[model samples]
Target chain A: MDIVIYGTVNSIVFALIAVGFTLVYGVSRIPNFAHGSIYVLVGFLTWSFVNDLRMNYALAILLSLTIAAVVGFIMYRFILIRLRGMATSEIIASFAVSLVILEGLRMQGIGGFKGFIGPFYVLRPFIEGKMNIWGVFVDFQRLIIIGGGIAVVGLLWLFTHHTKMGLSLRAIAQDERAAMMLGVNSDRTAMISLSIGSALAGLAAVIILPLGSVTAEAGYKVLIYALAVSIIGGLGSWAGAVLASFVIGFAMKISTAMFGAVWESVVLVGTIILILLFKPSGLLGKQKELEERV
Target chain B: MSMLEVSSLMVFYENALAINNVDLRCQKGEITGVFGANSAGKSTLMYTISGIILDIEKKERMRGGERVTVLGSIYYEGADIIFMETSDRAKKGIILCPERRRIFPESSVLENLKIGGILATRAQAKKTLDYVFTMFSPLKGLKKREGGFLSGGEQQMLAIGRALMAQPKLLLLDEPLLGLSPMMEEILVRAIEDINETTGITILISEQYARPILPIIHHGYVLENGVSVLEGTSQELMDNPDVKSAYFGI
Candidate 1:
């Protein structure tokens, strides 16, 4: 039961990280490999602010989100915009940016080191007690993670579905040139989407900080898992990503329990390949229609 | 007064000239037709006038007298607006219904129309949408359907309806009758004429087929290899010996 709750919490948090990656790719049609770097950078920045500078946890979290948003905006304006018509170059650029960011952090004495910043006081009480349900003892921390994940997902859905900006985004994602011709500003839309996605990732990172120590390279595993979930769910569909996340999260947990942590990634990778082979359009992706549109 | 004036307009692809020393004019409330064979630079001229092909890199190669051109310069209740972004140009009553019926395929027909009316206020958009629905009543049932699912004729109607929602002073229709059956072509031609008659919007249509379009247009130009070889009233062009031998193949 404990393992099950842990798996659920891990999956939800990981899904949020994946959502950011998926949203940017969906709208821009560029595989943003640098997204993983952004996640790790935010985690490290939050840690440095709270532990190194001894700042308040709230203030650190705020600063972390702000930094992530600014960086995302800058990357879009400087890097992505220049490579707009060249998609392959844009993907390569993102990969290059990820390397620069990761290496820069390492050179600055922030890499190859594990740092645990805070068992944030506000969240400490949640993990203090455990509840027994159906012969399984569920930690309050795990419950909070799961509940918070659902709330965030619901809010994201509302924003994407109900808002005018969200509607514009969907239109742009469908046909960028047509959207531009229709007066939808692609740059502003992309910037806003990237910021929102990165902020959500920052929030998830802050939430998960208490569960484990964070390293400079801590985001790679989560990145891989999230990408796998996204591909399995469908490239641009939010509903697919969420459902895939749960499947991946649970599957990983069960596999880890049965096998070991070493073989867990292999199983996840195999499952993704199988899904891709069978359902190339993904679970929720519109197969024939969108391809023709593109 | 002429609504648009172009003189000695030259366009190039890489190093080769595509449109060489092209000059043309369109008067207010007139439907001008540009007839050309494949690769005759008709589309290139339209793209150049619409500012889709910028002179950023090609400025050095451009050379001609009276090269200065004015687009959307006609006084519409006292306003000059030739230099505007495509969307801004659209808002100020200069809309282009591009070739291939460039509809937002993934979007619903209603959404596509709404996007076309993006520059207008919400109430204005609503009113314009209603006007579009009235103009293309066949589109009323397909409002919720995605643009990709619509038949070619329906998509063409939706494309024209979308341009109408912009409330244009001049609408550019690039090959509206392309890829349509004879019946569909007739329907589209009638729709185009009806829109012009009812709204008083000036139109410039580019086409490869001259027979169907010549009857509807007031003036026409025969373009061969990017240069205008013949310019006359539609009836004169239709009756001209050279036009008959070269274009009409009659």
Candidate 2:
């Protein structure tokens, strides 16, 4: 019961972290490397608003998410737009942006603001209580993560499948020229994607960061976790991402329960290596052979 | 005045001329056909008129790949829109049913049409959806089916239906009958005629085999190696010895 409950919570956590990354890549073919920085930025922004500015907690989160979205729009419009098609340059440029944002947060003497360098910044949980499920004690925040993950996935499905803008986004994803022929503007869709992706990263941060402290190092760790889920699930494959999250989540949990906590990272890395060696495209990923056959 | 007028149009991909100094016109509410063999620049001409070439050109430039150059004047409804963005052109009612039926393979047929209706008003989309079903009844049954799984003929039907969803004023069909059976070809030819007659939409259709298409077009142009070698009415093209021998398999 404990394993099942905690494993689900862990999987949901991974899914939340990687969903934003997968969305941006799937829609616009852009690997937004600043995803992690955006996550950390939102956490810090919300913290600063609530603690430093003494604003309402809910209002602070809303403002933080909005800022995250604006950041994404600016990142794509100003920086990534120039380096659209070149894959290597895209990665390098987005990574550079991530470095600037993450490192800048820790830099001293920026507008008389002290650097966010400690493990003291933490988001208060939405509801501070524990619930018993099948004899397993699970916190409300973890339950909220599971609910939020499901809601995000469901809402995204509806958006892509039903709404006009969402349908255009999918159309562009499949074939940009074809979409354009039908009047779907590629640049607009890409900008919308980046904005939504950044906001999602911020949403994940606020939902998950409540469980732990917000640190600059957490940004890198979140990015690695997101990347691990993406790669193991096959990059840009949503169903594959969710599946890989569960796979990694359970593997880490089982290993920790059996051997020790030290085996957690080992299991995560080992699973990624095995997936790369065997099915590099992922279990549910769209295969090149299938694309050619179609 | 013609719905679209192209004058001295030239397209080059790194010094290889794909379309060379070709001029063509599509009269309003009339069917215009361009007949050519493989590599005769039919698709290139379609891309240029629909402004898809600009996108290809931009992408090529971005990748440091081929240097695509286009020199021409395209007057659509008396406005020079040579350098208009493809999507903007689409918004102005220039929609291209691309070659190979580039339907959203992952999307259902209904979703595919809905996506094509992005620029349409709500009522227009609803009416067109009904009209598409009436025109291509096979698509009605396959509304929930994934586009990739449909047969080539159905895909072509869905492609045209999808284009209609966009409410195109001047429709461009690039090799719409590329790999279909004779029966499917006939069905599409009839459907094209039907769309032109019912909606009064100007159509510029390109095909390698002119047998099924030549009968429907009011005016026809025979392209040979990137140049418009001959231009005439359907009867004129069919009666000409050269067009008869080369295109009609005489």
Candidate 3:
């Protein structure tokens, strides 16, 4: 019962982190390498708003997510727009932007040698309560993550299927040129994709960050985890990303329970390598490059 | 005014001319056929008219690959629209049903039609969608089917229906009958005729086979090696022995 409950929570967290990256890749074929930095930036932004400015938690969360969306929009419109269609340049440019944002925040740390942020830099959870179910106890935040994550995925599916703009975005994902012929503007679609992707990253940050303290280094760890799930599931495959999250989520939780905390990363990295060696396209991926050569 | 006019249009991919000083016109409420064999620039001309060539040229240049040059003048509704962006061109009622029926593979038939209806107002989309269903009845039962799994003829029908959903004043059908059986070809030809006659939407259809398309087209241009070798009405082309043997497999 414990493994089932915690493993589900782990899987939800992983899916939330990876969904943003997979979406941008699916629509525009550009891996937004700045995903983790955006994730951490939102955590920090909300933290400062709530702690330093002494704002309401709900207000701060709203402000941080909106800012993240705008930041994503600007990143695509100004920088990534010119670099479109060149995957290598896109990766490099996003990585550079991410590094600058993260390192710039670190430099804002209190003094010279010591960083400004420490484990003490944390955001209070929204509910501020705990729940127990069937002989296992978990916080309200964990329950929200589980429930909220599934809701997000379901809502996204409905949006893409039933809404005009969402349908256009999916059209752009499938065939950019065809969409263009049908009057779907590529630039506008890509910009919107970036905006939504950024907001999603921020949303995940807000939901998951309360479980742990915010740190500059956490950005790197988040990026690695997101990338690991994406690669293991198959890049740009949405359903694959969700399903792979569950796989890795359970694996990591079981490993931690069996060996120790140190074995978690080892298992994560090991799973990625094994997947790459055997099925590089991932479990649910139908990416163009991974199309069978024969 | 003609629905579309092209004059002195030439396209080049690094000195290899794909289209050479070609001029074509599709009258309002008429069907025009451009018949050509492989590498005869049928697809290129279609792309150029739909303004997709501009995009292709830009992408190639950005990637430091082939340098594409397009020299052309296209007049629509008595105005020069030679250098417009593709989506803008589409918004102006010039929609292209691309070669190989480039349907969105992952989307279902209904979703694909909705995407194609991006340019229209809600009412127009609804009207056009209903009209499409009536015209291509095969698509009615396959609303939930993904495009990737559709047969070639079914995809062609979906492609045409999708373009119609955009509420086009002029539709460019590129290789609509490609890889279809004889019966499928007949169905599409009749459907294309019906669409043009009933709706009065100007159509510019390109095909490799002249036999199936020749009778329906009011005007036809026979292209060879990127050059228009013969231009005549249907009856005149039927009387031309060279065209009969070359294109009609006489």
Candidate 4:
């Protein structure tokens, strides 16, 4: 039961990361490989500001979010906008940006070194208390992470369903040309979606940093897991991302416990391949040919 | 005075002139129908006027070195609008119900309408939504239906309905009656007339078949091989032997 709870908590955190990937791809029709870099950069920046400069945790998170949002906006304006209508070029450009960011972090002396901070010290005592059920001890941190993840997902679902901007984004995702004809500014909408997505990734980074020491190289691994989640979830769907994250998370944990850590990635890759073979669109993906029908 | 004026306008695609020194005008509250063959630049004219085709980026060269100018000027309510973006032009009441009935296919009918009303204030959007529903009563019943599932005729109605939601002063209809049953075509013609009569909105409709559109338009232009060879009132064009031979199959 404790193992189950741990898997559930880790699944939720990974789901948050996958949601950002799905959101940007859904609206912009770009894979956005640099998204994982943004996530890692934010975590490093937050660590630097809070642990090194002795800033408040709340202030550090806010500053990190702002920085991510600004970088996202500039990237869209200068790079992504020019790459629009060129899918291959856009994917290549995103990959290049990811490499640049990763190397930049290393050159700046923030890569491959595990850095730890205890900003959640106040909540530590409460979280340290264990709840035993069915001969299993569950920690409070897992509960908090699980609850927070669910809350974030719920809030995003509500916003996308109930808000005007959210509806606009969905409309663009469905048919960008039609959305533009209806007076939706594609550039502005893309910028807002990218900003929101980057901020969500940043928030997830902050939440996960306290659970383990963060390093720049951590992002690539997390990104691989997130991509697997995204593929299993359906590339452009929020609900699919969440569901896939849980499935992969649980599978990975179980596989790691039974076999070893090395088998976890192998299991994930195999599942994704099977999913693609059976249902190429992913679990929650809308019908691709429906657009051609109209 | 004309609501929109184009003089010596030239359009090209990779060194090939699609519209050559075309001159046209649309009067207020008048339906100006453009008649042309498939590649005679009818759609190109509409796209240029709507500012969809970027003249600068898509340019090769103009015949007279004018560099593919959209001369002399386009005016809406007597205001110069040559420099406005497509979205700004939409906000200023110039709307395009483009060919293919480009509705947001995955969105519900109501959501599609809301997208069209993006430029309006919240209160105004609500009012426009109500107005659109009234204009197309069938849309009110199918407000929750995804646009992709709608029939061709229904999608056409939704497209026109969406444009109405924008409260357009000048509406550009590119092939409004294309690919419709005879009954559907009649209904569309009547609906367009009703819109013009009630709202006093000016409309420019381009059509290959002049039979159905000639009776509805106030004036018409006949484009042949990328040039405006004929221009007159609808009745005059209907009687022209050249028009009869080229378009009407008389």
Expressed as tens digits, the lDDT of each residue in B1-250 for candidate 3 is 6789999999999999999999999999999999999999999999999999989998999899999999979998888888999999999999999999999998999989999988888999899999999888999999999999999999999999999999999999998988999999999999999999999999999999888999999999988889998999988988899998887668
Worst 10 residues of 2 chain A by lDDT: A283-292
Tens digits of per-residue lDDT, candidate 4, A234-263, equal 778777899898888888788888898999
- Over 4 Å off in model 2, which ranges? A291-294
- Cα lDDT computed for each candidate against the true fold: 0.74, 0.92, 0.91, 0.78
Better of 1 and 4 by DockQ: 4
Across residues B1-250, which tens digit of lDDT does each residue of candidate 2 receive? 8989999999998999999899999999999999999999999999998888888998899998999999989999899999999999999999999999898988899999999899999999999999999989989998899988999999999999999999999999999999999999888999999999999999999999898899899999989899999999999999999988886668
lDDT of 2 at A200: 93
- Score chain A of each prediction against the true chain A by TM-score and list the results: 0.86, 0.97, 0.95, 0.88
Selected candidate, larger DockQ, 2 vs 4: 2
Q: What is every candidate's C-alpha DockQ against the true complex, given to 2 decimals?
A: 0.25, 0.89, 0.87, 0.34
Q: Write the per-residue lDDT of candidate 4 for residues B1-250, one digit (tens) a residue.
A: 8888877777666567888888889999888899987898888787777766543332223222334444445566677666566666776778888888988877789878877776677887788787777777888889899998998888999999888877788898988888999998888888888888888999998888778888888999999888999999989999999988876788
TM-score of 3: 0.97
- Model 2, residue A262: what's the lDDT? 92
lDDT of 2 at A288: 47
Candidates sorted by lDDT, best first: 2, 3, 4, 1
Predicted model with the maximum TM-score = 2
Candidate 1 lDDT: 0.74
